[model samples]
Target: MEHVRDSFARQKAMTLIGASLASLEAGASEIRLPYRADLTQQKGFVHGGIIGMIADSACGYAAYSLMPASASLVTVEYKINILAPARGSLVARGKVLKSGRTLTVARAEVYADDGTHVASMQQTLMMLPDTPDTPE
Candidate 1:
């Protein structure tokens, strides 16, 4: 998963939000983000958009983990459900449900620092198997 690690490291969005690649394995991946005031919505909880961002990336990377080294991916669509007010640090666990040649399905569940399920996301990712990643 070195490529996965490298790709994630180069993601400016993740870096901007202070997210880190916590773990990565075939068909599964995890991302972690520490709580920050700038990430909060008006109600003093993490913003829904930020939660979706991490969830999408988590699922996208999970699908990418199962693809060929040269493959590039894009999330065609994703549906996210925010279940609770997120506080403290967050962990998003992503798992691949199905891996196809050109389309993949994956899910990501976000948990609060206390382990409460705060959000869930499922995404459809399109893979370009012959496309290579951009240089860092």
Candidate 2:
């Protein structure tokens, strides 16, 4: 949907990491990240933190897709497991596990260019209805 695409496009963090929204549907989304030397570790594989970042956003977007138009969301907590060394490009697929009025649970799996499973994540997100500006 336009709303989802627009929100993803406005995410500066995704742009900083050279990631793109590959596809999205209600309750599901995918992110593609190109491999870059700056994102790798000494082992020449993508760092776990970078992997976690994309997985987190991937799940977050999935949860957001199902939220009401007037609501915005934030990650409450997430657990990610790195399964293999990530090389080349990566694609992360996320799907909502449960959608609630106030909380949503989502999961994601990252795969390497050759389709090697690289990481998995489960996340909890809190949906907040838009409100007037509040003190930060």
Candidate 3:
């Protein structure tokens, strides 16, 4: 949706790192983040923490896309598995599994440009009441 795309465009980190929204439909979103020297760890591989952050952001945005404009969400818990060392570019795809009035559960997968499965993550997001100034 245009709103989602606009919101993503305004995200400084996503913009600065060149993360792009490849696709979005229903309650899912696919994002791509190219690996640059800045994304590398001291050993020259993509940092594990960066991988987790991508997964988290992907899932969070996917979940947010399904909610009513008045509802806001935040990650309450996340579990991630690093299957292999990440190098080069990465793609993250997220999908919403379930959504309730108070919680949403989502899953995401991170893959290397070579199509290797690098990591996977699942997160639980809590819906919070929004004040007038921060309405969703």
**Leading candidate by TM-score:** 1
Across 10-119, the per-residue lDDT of candidate 3 in tens digits comes to 66767777788888887899999998889889998899988888888789789878866555678999999999989899999999999888899999999999999999
Could you list the CA RMSD of all candidates, in the order they appear? 1.1, 2.4, 2.3
**Candidate 2, poorest ten consecutive residues by summed lDDT:** 127-136
lDDT of 2: 0.90
Candidates in order have lDDT scores of 0.93, 0.90, 0.84
- For model 2, residues 50-135, the per-residue Cα lDDT tens digits are 89989998998898888766667889999999999999999999999999889999999999999899999999999888831122
Candidate 2 clashes between residue pairs 3 or more apart in a chain or in different chains: none
Report the number of the highest-lDDT candidate. Answer: 1
**Candidate 2 TM-score, C-alpha based:** 0.93
lDDT of 1 by residue, 24-117 (tens): 9999999999999999999999999999999999999999899877888999999999999999899999999999878999999999999899
**How far does residue 27 in candidate 1 sit from its true spot (Å)?**
0.6
Error of 2 at 55 (Å): 0.4
* Candidate 1 Cα lDDT to native: 0.93
Worst 10 residues of 1 by lDDT: 127-136
lDDT of 2 at 21: 96
Off by over 4 Å in 2: 131-136
